[model samples]
Target: MKRLRTSIRVKLTIATLIPLVTAIALCWVVGASIITSRFSSQALYTVETSLNSAHELFLGEQSRLSDIIRLTSRLPELAENLSTSGPTASVAPLRLLLGNEHLSFLTLVDRNGLVRYRAANPSFNGDSRIGDKIVSAALKGAVTSGITVLQAEQAGRENPQLPGKMVIRLKATPHAYTSSKTMEERGLFLVASAPVLGSDGKLLGAVYGGILINSDNRLVDRITSVVFQQGDTDARVRGNATMFLDNIRIATTVRDEQDKPAIGSLMSEEVFAAISRGTKWIGRAFVLKEHYFTAYEPLRDLAGAVVGALYVGMPERPLMQLRSQVNIIFSCVLLFLTIIGVTLSAWIGSKMTRPVRALADGARRITAGEDLPDIHVDSHDEIAELADEFNIMKHRLAIREDENRALNHTLEQKVMERTAQLEEKNQQLLAAQKELAESERLAAVGMLASGVAHEINNPLAIIRGNAELLEMTATLDNPANEEVETIIRQTDRIERIVRNLLTFSRSGIKRLSLVSLGILVDDILDQVGHQIPLDQYRIVRNYRDGEIEVEGDEGQLRQVFTNLIVNGLQAMEGGGMLTVETSLNMAQQQANITITDSGPGISAEQREKIFTPFFTTKRDGTGLGLAISYGIVTDHAGEIRINGEVGTGAVFTVVLPLRQKEVDELS
Candidate 1:
């Protein structure tokens, strides 16, 4: 009896505790996933908000600097005195002007790319660092902006005498001042530059001015003081933020801790590369042996060229400590819940086991073929009722066994019939799904075909008009001949368009061959350039020196380039610049060809549907250009990336892997 009771107790205990344990385990897993996801999302939001704030600050500073440059350029005495008195005489006034809290070092570079004058104490003298790209660009009436690690000689000081002297220079055209001369001799530099126009609206020169970031300016001190302030009594945290001009770290509150100024320290390769690529980055970085979450953005001058990068960083340790504290609190709560659940399960299991064990023992006696024994129950409960039922069941078992078998057979037959019905319904559902897919495909194809047909008709009309003009002027072979030739070329382009349409509509892989990209791009440009209105737009090509070869269908690849170029032209309805660049992406082992357009950029919502057939933003657009181009590129096992900002313009980059010799041979 005791053995039978124990068996029943074990079964009941397992039944009660298993489900409770499972529920607690599932709850823990779900809770952890939710908390982790929330934490990650919040972290990303905080970073994005901080970056936006930093971007606004950068823009404000840029505008303020531009204003200073404009105001200072109008000062007639300063320009006249500096120009006529040679390089040495300009130092005193420059030093006085730079004495202002916001002004940095003053520089005067000539058109021949020479730093003719600098304002640095007794070391002020004329130095010629001619043939520099910035000076050349400035001479050509363009603002040259970029960050560079200033060497001792390139620091704008004549003697290189000033210890740890570095400056971020903005070179611009000088306005019409009394000392105004040629574009080269009159080039001005301060911090920022503004174009100076004469009363007659004639171009004169540019004026430049800048704030000295490294000096004991109150602005820097104030920002640090507020953010690093601790409790009362004027105490503060020992933290600092520094500014880097070019690759050189110039100004910082923490400079005193270091043995030497960080003014000439070269930026890390990663940071330099990002700035060069015009990309802004924000993340944790180790600077001066301390980890900081740094917000970095490229600084641009009036011409929208990146001159320098601004970095605002705060120590990451404090934020990490806070995160750790949160994690600890969460872990403790989870641990407490876990302990409670385990304890409750143990108590409930013990309570359920006793009655279950009694029933189990009674069942075992019947299995042992003993005369049925009456079960004695301590409590009048469900278990006691079950025990009485078991005794009755054992008495009637021999008589009811045959009837039970027949009932089970009938249930099995019904289950088989229901299973067959479910299978038939599943097949019908699958067929419907297939038909829906086919309908979607046909809709897509129809839209693409309609747009392609419409786009081709316009060019076809132009071709026809040109041919008629040529036919009428057959006898005249001068200007009219040239006009006829131009017409024939346009007609050929229309034919190419029709060919691309047919290729796109028919979905089949074409034969590919190993082709040199340099030659391929040149050939496509020769054809597509004639189609675009070149007078309104400029095409800037930035292809690498070496051959970029890949396995692809030449005709199909030509269609892809044509489609992209046409799309870019269509985007810039009012005419703008188009930049096509090619380079090897070493990490990805692919050649990246990027087409950038200086037009209103694509929105995020629009970008999602850009490759979909027949989706277009333009009234007269066929939209199949991008869709067909996308298909061709995908067929070649390549990836295409489209990225843009609303006002900044758009870039479409295609990455195709380099073809191996073996694969090329096989093709």
Candidate 2:
């Protein structure tokens, strides 16, 4: 049991190291799949982008060369010299057209797809026929342009000597000579055909133009530069483009170990099969025993036949090296964290046990009522916290023990002194209490008598003096207005006392009458702002239908309006707006008087019992305003409701019947 308890270091090792190992394993398992999927997708995107670019370049060359052929085919020499001067005499003009352009193949062919004039290989003007699809389409007066692979023997040149590019031409129908060489094999060429017409649009002959791509070409080199060119050599994004004829790479920028053009090399079996089936193959491929991110697109001929493939690829090594470097960094960081965690955990475990053991021993000593010394711990860890707590407890215990010893020594003297002090204080307290009792009795009687006499005699004195002053100052013709005002003020002071006592003491049966809400509200506002400045609040009056009359007691309704408006104004500190809106709801035939204030609103708890009798939130309040208001509203066959939450100020909505039909019938 001791061994198990003490082996915290081992426990920490197993606890920390296991998760690290699991994490490493998890990273190893998932990292390859994620990296491969993401990097491969990026590589394929680049390749596909390059392939589409190549297709555009190919079409551009065809279109530009087709325009040249159309312009050339309309020449008067082309139609006149074919029969009179014969086919061989036109080679100079055809070669001149090919001179200023990058065109590789330009041949004057009759409508039957027979080559009449050849610019490059002009010496072999034999009666050789061509089965080139673009030429055949041009023979039918259809201008065509496309990519096609020609056999070696058909061009009368060796495989390496073939022009590595081609394009079709456009022309009208003329004629074809019966030829002998019909089954000759040819190398790859992109060709264009255009119909040649006389000045009057009559079919004359068709012109065929082509560029050879069966050898290393500048077109593919430029494509490679444009698509995958990057500045970094160490992490270079190396790319190669190829013109593939079905399975064989006819012309490519892909290089062999001898730094020769990797021409005539076969595409991978998988890529070839997919391309043969007209599928675009984009994935990782092993070319020249090195992996590449390759994209292959099926090349279609003039007749829309799948004849070859266009390919673009970036070397896979750089991407792989990037992944490997990332993996190495991750492993180094993981190892560093694991080592740090294990070292920290081990140090903590070793340091922890000693303090815990010391604390346990100290706790045992404390249980036996033995003195304990301070426990010292320097590390900033949980173990140090525990030690600190123990030290604090030990210090408190020492203080208590010292107090106990001192208390034991001074107990008898303390009792004697305390008893003497208590007796003295008791006699003094007894005399003080008797005098205090007499004072309290006299204070209570004096306060009551004084308060009653002051309250009653002051008002009576004011009334008597004001009356005497009025009597003395009055004249038959002229009355002293100041003396009359003093009399009126004294009477009002006495009336206020009576009013406060009588209000809400007993619920008075309200007298109902036809009342205009606007008139009642106006009267209350004029009376209430006597002390307060009315300009402190913006009074917004919105009466939807003017002069809304409700059947209610005039005095009671006035009191309700007075209480609500005063309360609303008082609720707003530093002045806020007050909205008094009246609307007659025709559907319910009730008058709604909404008195709202932009004030620090009533809370939920305050609103609940706001109308409860004698329930007030104010320091000096009668708490009878809303209660009396509620009673009056109910008696008038109306409903008074306060709507709003804590923050949105209070809205006291009084909904009263236009004519209290129920109450009126009863009356």
Candidate 3:
């Protein structure tokens, strides 16, 4: 098994990051733990404080009821009427007391515990007493303050329940035919009692008054308003206050999940049990359908027995959300720190490896026998000392290399001299081999052309002789004379094709002369005009309005330009420009003629075979014209080449060496 290789940078990064990541992870763990614990504690404290505030307001309300009841009993007019007149008393003073918005129910009972007056139900004044602990105690001449569930028909039970003030139905109800007073259980009240005595302090009757907190308003709203004030926390999340009589939630600002008043739901079993024991349960508890950070305090009777509980709860969702937001902020901070650590790690890695990389590169250069610049040893360290030693070794090696080069230089000179002589001989041998191959190729082609020409010449001679006979012997108006004329023309074309093949195969010579290329091109075009559709093309002669003389075979040069021009004209199937340009090539001591056409151009593949004997692009071509033309140009010590692309057209250039002797004669 192979272990992977690492550079100095990787080692440095690993060494740095292990401790960095470990420290960060440790810090993160500790921070999250501390933050969550603190949030839990602080959040509970807020809820408990709210609960305490609500409880204080509730107690104050109880005291206010106590004050109203005790104050009414002390009224001088009330004591005088009740004592002198009893059950049939005027009772106008008690009516005035019940008018207080805070007071929900008010009554006066005689010493026999019979109702003398009822403020809530005025027509039922002589009804049986509203017997609760406070009322009972009050009738017994003992002043009391407490929460008591008034008897049916006492706490406005006899008063018809309005259709609009419906509570959530929790229990089974009596039949519709059943009397509402017989089946209904009235809700709880915060009541106060004080004995009504005569002016002599003799017990005459008792005044019982209370504020009903059942399905009640303003009182619970006041508790919530006092406990939770507006701030960063939303009022809905601040949650509302609730009071429960035993298991029944009687008066509340708390709402169900639907946002309606949660007037009929019970407390969680844990919270209910704890409050039933008359102790505060402070923490998270499920009530209704949601969870809250809550506090529950017992609501006791005047005898100091727990009969109900006062509760304040703040919804847990907001507290948990704030906690999550804090955690996210810390997480983002951790992420930023991690990114910084990674960046610093990379920088430190580079710093550690940079010098080592430079040293390795320098060593490689020296080992390969390359001259090296001096390395600066800026550090006062062992690495710097090592660089100094390396520079000394490099200097010694450079000196040794110089001495070795001097010795090798003389030996290399002798070898180069011998190698040059050998290369010259090799070139001479290759030239001779090429000449021999060419001579053999020419001999074979000539033999084949001579045989084919001889066979065609016999028929051509017979055809020409017969045409002459017809021209001399045939009479005018003979239709056969026209056919005979056509025969002569066709035979002449065949004869030219045979002549071209022979010239190409034999590499034939011609009479050399100083020729005007302009006159020669014009003569060739005049001859071609009769054979081709010359009127279908635009002939552009750009011969520079002067004569440029060149040393060449007059007959062969004419054939070359003629073939080029005719090929150009024939290629223009849709009728196009045919240009013949002649110029002097002063630089190369030559005269140039160019024939170009606006026609479907020659391609690279076709150009290669254009001057090859027996190869042609045309359907009825003997393929000998350009071959003979190529041979004739080469024999005259001149050059010819085709230039073309796929769609632009073709230009054939013939460059003939100028005659220096002819130039001197002309001058």
Top candidate when judged by lDDT against the true structure: 3
Alpha-carbon local distance difference test for all models: 0.59, 0.70, 0.71
Predicted structure with the largest TM-score when compared to the true one: 3
Deviating ranges (above 4 Å) for candidate 1: 1-30, 75-95, 107-150, 154-163, 167-190, 193-272, 282-295, 299-308, 313-339, 356-381, 390-667
Per-residue lDDT for 186-281 in model 2, tens only?
Answer: 456767777766667766667777677666467777777677675543322478888876566567787765676666566777677788888898
Write candidate 1's Cα lDDT for 253-311 as tens digits.
Answer: 43323443333343455665677678876665555545555556675544566656655
Compute the lDDT for candidate 2. Answer: 0.70
Residue 648, model 2, lDDT: 87
TM-score per candidate, chains pooled? 0.42, 0.49, 0.51
lDDT of 3 at 660: 31
Sort by lDDT, best first: what order?
A: 3, 2, 1
Which of 1 and 2 is the better model by TM-score? 2
- Candidate 3: pairs in clash: none
